[model samples]
Each structure stands twice: as C-alpha cells, then as structure tokens.
Target: MPAGVTTEGCPDSIHQMEVERDDTHSLKRSMSTMQLTMIGVGGTVGTGIFFILSEAVPEAGPGVLVSFLIAAAVAGLTVLCYAELASTIPSSGSSYSYTYATMGELAAFAVGACLILEYGVSAAAVAVGWSEYLNLLLNNLFGIQFPDALSAAPDAGGIINLPAVILVVLCMLLLLRGASESARANAIMVFIKIGVLGVFAAIALTGFNADHFANFAPEGMHGISIAAGSLFFSFIGLDAVATTGDEVKDPKKTIPRALILALGIVTLVYVVVAFAALGAQSAEDFEGQKASLATIVQGVVGSTWPGTLLAVGAVISIFSVTLICMYGQTRILYSMGRDGLVPPVFAKVSPKRSIPLVNTFIVSGAVAILAGLLPLGILADLTSIGTLSAFALVSIGVMVLRRTAPDMHRGFRVPGYPVTPILSVAACIYVISGLHALTLQAFVGWISVALVFYFLWSRKHSELARLQAQAENLTGDQV
Candidate 1:
C-alpha cells in the first residue's frame, strides 16, 4: 500500500484517477478569454437587470444605485477568491470542487447543495423572466400577447408559464449537442443583449430629469442594505467564469482575467442602466412594472418601437442565461458524481459529443417545472440565499487552504489575502442577514434535505471509503 493510503480514507481515490483520465480525453479546451468572458456575461446579466428594478426600486427607492455598487463590491471580493481557487484546483465543480480539495468532503457536499439553488433555481428564475420579455416583445410588435392564464404561474392567477417551460426545453436540446456549440450560441446572445442595453441607455438618457434625485435615500441606509441583498441575484453568475476553468485555454491566466473583466463590465452596465432608468422616471413608479426596462424605454422614447427592441433583446439574451445556468448545474453534479458524492449517471460523459447529456436533461426538466409553477420573486430570493451561502464557504476555504496547504501551487493568489477573504465572508453574512424570513426558512429546509441525503446515501457509497478499505487490507498483507 502507498504510504498515504489507509482505511481512514485517502485523499486520492481510484475513482478520481479514472475521472481525471476521462476528463483529459473528453472535455474540449476551446474557450478563449473572449468566450469565457461572454459566458460570465450571459450568465450574470439576464433577469437581474431586465426585471429586477420592480423589486429593488420599491426597497431602496432612488438609492438602488448605491445598492448596485455595494452588491458589485461584495461580488468583486468573492470572485477574486474564486479566481484563486479555480486556478489552484483542477476540478470542474466550481466552489464545490474547491471546497473538497481545499476543505473536506462534508464542506463540499454542503457547498454543492447550495449551488443547486444558485445555478438550478437561478435558471428557473431567468426562464420565468424570459417569459415576461417574450410577452412584452409580442405585445410591442403585433399588439398581441399570451393571456394571463397561459403566461403566469398558478400563484400569479395563471394556469402555467408555457414559454418558460418551452425555453428550458430548447436550451436542454442545445446543451445535448455539446459544450462548444452552446458556447457559440451564448456568445451571439451576449452581443445582442449588450447592444440592446446600449441602445436603451442612449434613449433613456434623452429623458433624464434632474428633479428625480431630490429624495434619493428616502428609506435610508437600512433600505439600501436590504436592497443590495435583493439585488445580489443579479451578480450570481459572475463565477460561471471560474466554473469553466477546466475547459478554458490557459485557465491560470484566462480564469482570473475573465473574472475581473466580466465583473467590471457587468458592474458598469448595471450602474449605467440604473442611473438612466432613475433619471427617466420617479423611483416610486418602478414598482409593479411588469417589464421594467421596456416600460422605462417607452416612457423615454414616447413610442413602442424602442421598448420592443429592448424586449426582443432580453428575450434573445435570456435564452443564453438559462442555457449557461443549466450547464453549470450539470457540470457541478458531474463532478460530484465522479467523486461518488452522487450517482455515477450524473458523471457519465457522452462518447460522441463529450457532454453529460443525461445530467443536462435532468437539470432542464427540474428547472422547467420550477419555472412553470413557482413565482419569480420566490425563485430569485432562494437563489440569493444559496449563492451567498456558497460564496461565504468559498471565502472561508481560502483562509483554510492558506493554513493547511500553504505550499500548493496557485496561479493567482488573493491580493489582500486574509483581509480580502475575511471581508468577503463578512459581506456575505451581511447580505444574507438582510434576506426575508421566508427565504431563510426555505434555505434551511433545503439544506436539511441535502444533509439527510448525504448521511443516508452519499457518505456510505463514497468511492474513497471503498478504496480506504482495500488499502488497509493490502497493508495488512505486506506486514
């Protein structure tokens, strides 16, 4: 038996070796810096910007601009840690993989469960938002749209959200084709969305009124803080860049570079859009505006054409968001399956396309159900809770790895080290504290379910445990 091998559970299991070999041969390394950056953009810039104002503006009034800045700053700190870990770790599970390699199996399971919320439910939320924009587009172009019974969830006085479900299924089909194809599609959507936002900014600026700034902080600092927590949903997908580390060219450089670049660009866009929207109308008017950005555009341009263009852009771009988010969910589960934390079927790679087709299908099906049945506000709030929890864990993992494996080779180190990670953790805690009581309750219920599954199932079936038993018996024979 090798010196490090024991029944206590070795760090390097046989299954992991096989998984690594498969990954080397299967997963394609075709993502350049540009592709990677756009993936992050595609993931992060969807519902958060297009539909979030209705919720955020009511919370923070005109001061939501400050919320955007605060959310960006916290996201910035968190992704710096993600860049370092993604560069250091060789797994594709995003924070879950990093936690496993640097922290431990238990922590990895918890993080993985939280990620289900971040990526899976987040996809559902984006799909729901996409449905709204799709309806907006239809109404703008032909003066016709789906009835409430066909377009909304049951809770929202509708039968089913057909468009959201359909969108998820379409993305599922594209993903089954493989990663490269999906990446290309995502790149196209990214450009269309950004271009539309640019046009919106130009038209919105035309109606800018200085008087709207009179009562900027009507709700004070507490409102701004709470609003930042709600707005955190917009920033959830920035770490998708890190999740692609395994498939990216020169990941060491590309991962961190793309993280910073995407974060900066996204933050700037959010700030500009928020400013433009606030200038065009009163903060109180944002509430209950179904398609907020389009409504803002209509107010500014005094016509429906510009709003229609913006809606069309949102409908096009949010498709990419759903695709990428579901992709992230599958890849994370794929890594867990390889590690024996979940069923092996999840880790199974297609021989022809080199993609996890089954996993993708499962994720799409689940997301479609959620998108069709659940309310958007609930999905977004749940996503924020899960994402913030995962970010907090990753931040803590940075400090833990520094103490436990100081010699590990890292492509990029957190610039401020202890301070940055500490601040990241603190920031996550603050935002999480501001979430609604119902959101917290749902998160706790979900975590309880995940932990129960781990204890009764994943822990016993873990490959590392099996390998440890074999190593112990072999060592006895040698003695």
Candidate 2:
C-alpha cells in the first residue's frame, strides 16, 4: 500500500495492477444536445421552485425575488467551472473523480464523503417535501387526510413518513430495472414545471395588489441574503448536467449549450415564481404554510382546484428529482471504488444492467432513513452546505487544471478565465457564510466523520498502492 493512501475494507482481494481504461469502460455517448439540456433543467426545476420558494419568500420578503437572482448568479458561476472540468475530463464521478485524477487520493476520499451528503440529502429532502404535497393533493381531491399523526415525524409531530419512504423505494426500483431514465424525461418535467409556474404567475398577476410590494424589503438586505442562503440548495442540482460526462453525446458542444440553456430557464422560472408568490400572499403567510405551496394558492384562488393541480405537478416533478440525485450519488461512489479510494465492491457493476448495484442500495437505504426521520429544514440546510463546498472545489479545480495541465485538451473553457472561477469560489463562500449558525455546526459535525474515516481507513488501503508499485518497478529497471 502507498504510504498515505488507505481504505476501510479488504484491499488485497484484487490484484494491485494499475488498470488502464479503454472504450468499453467508457460510457456510450448516446445522449443528444436536447437530452443534456433536459438533465440540467430536470435536476433544477423539481421541488426547489415548486416547494422551497413558498418557504423562502417569507424570509426575504419581496426581495426574495432578488435573492433568486443572487442564488442564480452563484449557481451560474459554478456551472461554468463545472462545464470546463466535465468537458476537459469527460468522465463520471463528478468532483470525487476529478479530484482523484488531479489532486490525489486523500482529497478524493474527503470529497466523496461530502458528495454522499449533497446528492443523498437533496434526494431525501425532495422526497419528504413531495410527500407533503402528495398528501395535500390527495386530501383536497379526496376527503381523507393521511393524518399528521402518521404523516410526519415525532419531532415534527408525525409518526412515520410512509409516503416519502414509498416514493424513494419506487425511484430506486426504477433505477434498478436496467432502465436509466434519459434526459428527455427531465425536459418534459421542466415543461410541466414551467408551464404550471407560468399559469401561476399569470393568474397571480391579476390579483397583484401593489400592497404586497409596500414592505418589499421588510427583512432588509441582510434578511434577503439569509434567505438566499436557503434558496441556494434549490440551485444545487444544476451541475448534475456536468456530472453526466460520458453519458452525454458530443460533450464539448452539447455540454456548454445545455448548461447555459438550463441555467437561463431555471433562473427565469424561479424569479418569476418567487415574484408571483410574494404578490399572491405575504411573507408572513409562508411560515405557517411551509409544507406545500398549495396552501398559499388556496388562500389566493378561493378554490382548491388550482392548488391541487399545483400539488400534483410538484409530486410528479419531485419524484424525478429524487431519482436523479440518487443516480448521481451512486455513480460518484462507483467512481471512487473504481479508483480504489474505497472498496472495489462499489465499482462492481451489475453485469446484466451495467449499473453499480451495491452503491445504489447503500445510498437508497441511507436516504430513505433520513427522509423518514429528519425534519425537512435540517435536511435542506445540510444539503446546501455540502453542495456549496463541492461546487467550491470544482471551481478551484477548473482554475488549477488551467495552470497545471494547460496542455490537456479541453472541450469547453470557462469564459473570462480566472475571473469567472474566482467569482465562483467567492460566491460559494459568501452564501456558505450566511448559513444559520446551527447549520454550520451540523456541517462541521458531518464532515468530521468523513475526515476521520479517510485518515483512519481509506488512506491505509488506497489504490494509490498500484501507482507506488509501478514507480518502484521503474526504479529497479533503471538500476
């Protein structure tokens, strides 16, 4: 084994050969430009604008509209950095994979730890939020409620999140069936989300009393910044488009175009939705109606049908979001396994489906437990910090690659060079600083677990042993 690299499980089960990748190990680049765009939109449009917007609008006041733009700018900068890295590398495992190949094994292990929280928590949070809307749509359309007693948590005053767990299980099944849902499904979901949001904006525009704008900056700039911190999580998934490297067709051309297109669409929809929502109701109303935007719609529209329809759309869209987040999580683990930072079991693909089953199962189980047990607000905050930290890494990696491996052929280059990536890092830090003190404490607590594991286990058994052995052989040959 290498001096610093380590692992948690058996490392000698497989030969310590420095494996070389060929065309087969590579992903079949079959996704079209349009499909790639769908992924970015699909990952971004779900749950965030539909559900979180209603929750955040109250915090930022009408200025939450401005918070939308602030969050988008930060996300857009990170997406640019991701675009460069994805095109230059053209592989899976997103950040962990990139860091391993460029930074080293220790960095990779630590990154994999953070990624587990980012995608996994995002998926679980969306599932829990989806469950809330599902219950709302059901009770309005039907007469029976799932009852708060069993629908939520004991802490939040519910028993078991049966709906959330069920949805997570269903998404896991879909992923296991050898059917990797394509990016087009995302585009369609984006259409539904946007179309419904458009209707929501149009209708709300009619009831637009300027009175809603009277205390627009009620929370003030500081409050808006704090609200933007909350909104940041909703924008976290945009980079999933960059994460699906090998799966994308003509990555150089398709990747950049898709990222920009998706960012534009997502930002427009979020800002418009926040504006219309604040117009329809006051910020004070958002706190009590935290679960679903439907309650807000009911207050404004007087009938339950519009709100019910909105709930139906959110339920459908959030289900897909759960799937994508889990998909990214598993792929990241699989990449780490393939790199020998963890166990090779994670890299072991199902011969029948070409999917990493072990990694998928592990992620699904953890996410299910989390969504079923934790409060929605805690999960949301945890996911935001994890994602921002990851985005910050990718941004710096892009800049480093520009310097260290300047000759490496890049399919896409971040426009404005150093300026863009610098701003990306700065923006991520700014929002991260705004995190509630409790959120910061929890994030520190979560990452400490990963660091401890890396130093204690992963470093001792890392695949970097293979690289060390090769170096030794070269020295012997020279002698």
Give per-residue CA lDDT, model 1, range 338-414, as digits (tens).
Answer: 77889988988877787877888788889999999998987877887888888998899888877766765678999
- lDDT top scorer: 1
Which residue pairs collide, candidate 1?
none
Q: What are the runs in model 2 whose C-alpha is more than 4 Å off?
A: 1-27, 51-60, 147-150, 154-159, 178-184, 209-224, 278-300
Per-model tally of clashing residue pairs:
0, 11
Instruction: Work out the TM-score per prediction.
Output: 0.91, 0.87
127-240 per-residue lDDT for model 2 (tens digits): 888888788778888877677866786698888787888988987887676323545555666677777778778777666767877888887998788787778777777777
lDDT of 1 at 290: 80
Report the CA-based lDDT of candidate 1 relative to the real structure: 0.83
Candidate No. with top TM-score:
1
